[model samples]
Target: SDQISKDESMVGFVDDLQFFIDNRDGETVVGLKQKLEICGRGAAFNDAKKKKELFAKLLMRFERFSSAQQLFAYIMAAIHETFDTKIIPSTSSLSTQEIDAMIEAEIVDKIMAEIGEGSDHMTLNRTHIKGMIYWLADKCYVRWHCD
Candidate 1:
């Protein structure tokens, strides 16, 4: 059952990636590329070889599109999976940094809510919550703030 669930998730991810690749514009692709590069650099000291492999796969997949659409899709999917939010705010009104921060906050809020719900009287420590937020942020390539 777990394997089946994992397979289904992979299929969904691929479908989302294809949709993004087909629909994304140059600006979105550039932004995703920048984020992916940042993620790659951040991982170098901890797991250089794995990070290199992952980045190589990402770059190769990115080459299939005009730009980094796959990476964008992956990041968006990660955010949605973490926060249960599918809305990516339009860049027309908000700057990229603002949008990123908004998404990060939403993710953190969702995580905190889940942790609270799963605990007795929300007894989980601040450090644990912060750790989970940071882990999710790293996985999604988002900038997280405890504030």
Candidate 2:
């Protein structure tokens, strides 16, 4: 994804990510897992192996960025929030485009800010955000339909 903006505060992005990874306590890890489980099952992809492969590719892309962990967390939180406050309550499935729009509305600005602060040259765009969302859906971190 192309960068939306840049900022000087991003100088220490690498350090911040290292610190985040190094200091990941059990609570934090559990919270991530819980977020993933909140929506029960995902129906985006029916083939488990294919989903795993796609997730692996996305993980590779995520690792190349300085604020990988934070970006992942933000998207996960946004997905969970979207499902909890929107999709699940509606008790109906949303088209992928609709889900993408909702998720993007919630995170794009925040993510742009974080991305600016997370790297000097690396950037993220809607495509990358959607990729992350799709991977999460495939992994059962969020759902498009109520279960």
Candidate 3:
């Protein structure tokens, strides 16, 4: 059995955002390894059921987290789920407002401020968020795995 919790496993799937044990799964959540290989990315859904299901479940699961690592996992998962190139939803629940808010609440605004005003070509975007989440997840996952 893996010593790492499910949430830790989620890190590989998602990042450094904080997470903790939750009653929902009756144990620590799992982590991810390199971002979830979401199929179809964001697209259009065949029915409303799937749309509502993912939206509610995913968001609820995220609400259970207490730290950044956990939140990062959700963000990364969102990115993977919404990539739209490799694997996109037939109909995605994600919206610009929702995405922006999530990014702002969990990462974007913080990262932007932390980067400072030195000026550079790179700016906030899916790619930037992707890298940050991966790097952070990798670090936290390693720690949990090693311990």
Best by lDDT: 2
TM-score of each: 0.28, 0.47, 0.24
How much lDDT does each candidate structure score?
0.39, 0.49, 0.35
Better of 1 and 2 by TM-score: 2
lDDT of 1 by residue, 37-68 (tens): 54343333344334434544543443434223
Which segments of model 1 are wrong by more than 4 Å? 1-78, 81-87, 117-147
Off by over 4 Å in 3: 1-34, 38-100, 119-129, 137-147
Candidate 3 residue-wise lDDT, 39-77, digit = tens: 121232223224334433443454433343344455544
Count of clashing pairs, candidate 2: 0
User: Model 2: runs farther than 4 Å from truth?
Assistant: 1-58, 61-66, 91-100, 107-110, 113-118
